[model samples]
Target: MATTPSSAMRSLDRAFDVLGVLEDTRQPLRLSEVARRAELHVATAQRILNVLIERGYAAKEETGYVAGPAAVATAHAFLVNNRLSQVALPVLQELAATTSLTASLYVRVGHFRVLIARVQGRNPLRYQLPIGEKLPLYLGAGKALAAWLPDAELHSLIEQSAPFTRVSGEHVTAEDLAADLDQVRKAGYALSLSERAVNVTAVSAPIRHAEDVLGALSIAGPSSELTETDHTRLIGEVCRAADAIAARCP
Candidate 1:
C-alpha cells in the first residue's frame, strides 16, 4: 500500500526534527544520539539521514553527521527571502530616530528568539542588541513572543528557560507567567525592566498578520530612562511602530 499523505508529512516532520537537533547542537551527532534527542527510533532516524545525506543537506563525518552545504544554502535562502527584515529595516531606522533609543526586531527560533535587525539609539550609553544575537524567550523584550505562544509551548519554553536552582529566587511560576502574559495580550505590548539584565528596560510589541504573530519590535535603554512619563510615551511609540510593520507584512 502507498503511504498516506498524513504519514508522509509525519515522516517529513521527523526528518526536520532531526535537522533541528543537529543544528541546535552545532556539532556532528551519532545516529543513536540524534534518535534520542529527536525522539525517533534509530531505524527511522537512519532512514531520514539517508535521504538527507543523498540530498546533501547532511553529511557523515568520522565523528557522526553534520549539516552539509545544502543546509547552508537553505539558510542563505531563508535570509535572502526574509520578509520581516525587509519590512522591518526602514521601520526600525525610523523607530530609532523617533525614540532616540535602540530599536530591534526579534524572530522566534525554536526555544529561543534571534535578533535579526537593529538600529542604534542616539545616546551613547544605550542598550544594544546586535543582529544574530539569540536570547531566551523568558526574559526582557522576549516577553512579547512569550505572551502569544500557545499554552503547551509556552510552558515548555518556561521550563527550558530556567534552571532548577534559583539562588536569586527569580524562578517564575506558571501562575505568574500566566498573569504576565494576560496583561501583555490585553495591552498589546510587553514591558520588562531589570529582569534579565539589571538596570536595563525594554518595551516590546508584537508584529502580526491579523491574529498570527510574526515577531516583535522592541526599544531598549537604561532602566532610569523608563520613568512613569517615559513608560507611557515609549510604549505608545513601540506599539505604533509594531503596527506599521504589521501593516507592511502580509
Candidate 2:
C-alpha cells in the first residue's frame, strides 16, 4: 500500500519528538517515561523507538532507551569538520601556551559533552582529556555549555541528569550542581575544582554561533598551579578565546 502523506508526516513528527525527549533526558529512560514525555501512546513510542534503534540512533538498555554512538558521531561530524574547530584551535593553543594550562573544545551531544579536541600546555602537571571522551553536562566545561542553553531546556537536562555523582568518586548533589550552574550563568563562565578529577582545576566559557551557544572552551591544570588569581585569569582567557572563535565561525 502506498503511504499517505499525512500519515508519513505524523510518523516523522513522532520520531523527532522521541529524539528530542531522549536528548533532554541524557540518560536511558524507560519506555513508559519516554511515552509520557513525548505525549505518545506506549505502542507508538515503542514503534518509534524500535525504528530509532534499528537505525543506530538509539539504544535499548535495561533501564530504558538512550542515544546511540551514531547520534554522537553525526553531531561530531558537523562540529569537528566545520569551521568552528578550525577557528578555535589556534586560539586555544595560544591560550594554553600563554597560561601554561591545557585547553580543550567541548561540544554537547545529546545529554553529554564530548571533548572534541585539546591543546596541551608545556606544564607537566596539567590534566589531559583525550579527544572523544564524554563528560556529564553538569560538570566542568559541560556545565558552562549547559548553563547557556535555554532555561527550560537547561532545567529539563538537570532533572534528567539527577543524582549527579562524580566519576572521580566525589559526592555532588543535584542542588549543588544547580547552584554551580547559576554561578556559571552570572559569571559568564564555569569552574571546576577537582569535581571531575582530583587535584585538577578547570575554567570554561561558552562559544556562540549567532544566537545559539554551540559549545565551550576550557583550560585545565593542577589545583596548585590554578590558585584563585590564576583561575580568574584563566576565565578571562577562555572567554576571549571563545569570542575569537565565535567571530570567526562559519
Candidate 3:
C-alpha cells in the first residue's frame, strides 16, 4: 500500500528527532538510548535507524550507533554555502591571532545561539563549545545578539534561563539579565567573566547589516589571562572585528 502524506510527515519528524539526538550527543548510542532520547518506541526508532543507515546518514557500530559521513557532508555543505560563515572566516582568524583569544561567530536560532565558525587561540580554554553546538541565548557571548532582539523575545529567553547560577557560583536573576542587556546596548558589546564556565571569559559584539542584526562575533579565553589585559581594549578589538565582518557581508 502507498504511504499517506500525514504518516510520511510523522515518520520524517521521527527521523529528524533521532538524527538530532545522535548529533547533539556527539557519541555513539544504544538503540534503547536513541529511542528514549528521541521519545519514540524502540521498534519505531529501530525502523528509522535502519533507513538512516542504508542512506549513510547513520552507521551501526560495535559500541552502538553513530552519525555517519552524510551528516558531516550536510554540515559542510551548509558552511560552504553560508555567506556569513564564508565572509567571517578570515576575520575570525585575524581576531584570534591579534587578540590571542579564541574567536567565534554565532547565529541566533529561535531561543538558542549556534556556533557556525571558530578559530582557536594560542592558549586554549578548558571549556569550548564546538562548531554546530547550540546553547541558550542568555549565556555569555550569546547576550550580544540577544540584546538586539525585540523585547518580548528577549524577555522570554531571560525568564527561561534566569534565577540560574553561573559556573563561577554567582546567582543570576531576571532583573540582572535585564540590566546586563541594557548595558550591552549602551556599550555596543557584551563582557562576561566566568559567567558560563568557571575559568572562561568572553567579550562579544553584534554583527549588523544596516538596521538588521545578523549575528555576533566574540573572543573568549581563560579568565586568568585577562588579569593583566585591559578590558576596554579587548572590547574594542571585538567590536572592530564584528564591524569588519558585517561590512564585508552582503
Among all windows of 10 consecutive residues in model 2, the one with the lowest summed lDDT is 124-133
Please name the candidate that would achieve the greatest lDDT relative to the true structure. Answer: 3
**Candidates in descending TM-score order:** 3, 1, 2
The segments of candidate 1 whose C-alpha lies over 4 angstroms from its true place after superposition are: 1-6, 61-63, 108-114, 122-136, 149-169, 194-199, 222-230
How much is 104 displaced in model 2, in angstroms? Answer: 0.3
TM-score attained by model 2: 0.69
Candidate 3, residue 20: Cα displacement in angstroms equals 1.3
Question: Model 2, residue 165: what's the lDDT?
Answer: 71
lDDT of each: 0.83, 0.83, 0.89
Worst ten-residue run, lDDT, model 1? 160-169
TM-scores of the candidates are 0.76, 0.69, 0.85
Candidate 1 local Cα displacement, residue 231, angstroms: 3.9
Model 2 misses residue 237 by how many Å? 1.2
Runs with alpha carbons beyond 4 Å of true place in candidate 2: 1-80, 124-128, 167-170
Scored by TM-score, the top model is 3
Give one digit per residue, the lDDT tens place, for model 1 in 78-176: 767999899899999998998888888998987688887888878524345555667877776788988898879887876665442223346677667
Tens digits of lDDT, candidate 3, 40-77: 99999999999999999999999999988898789889
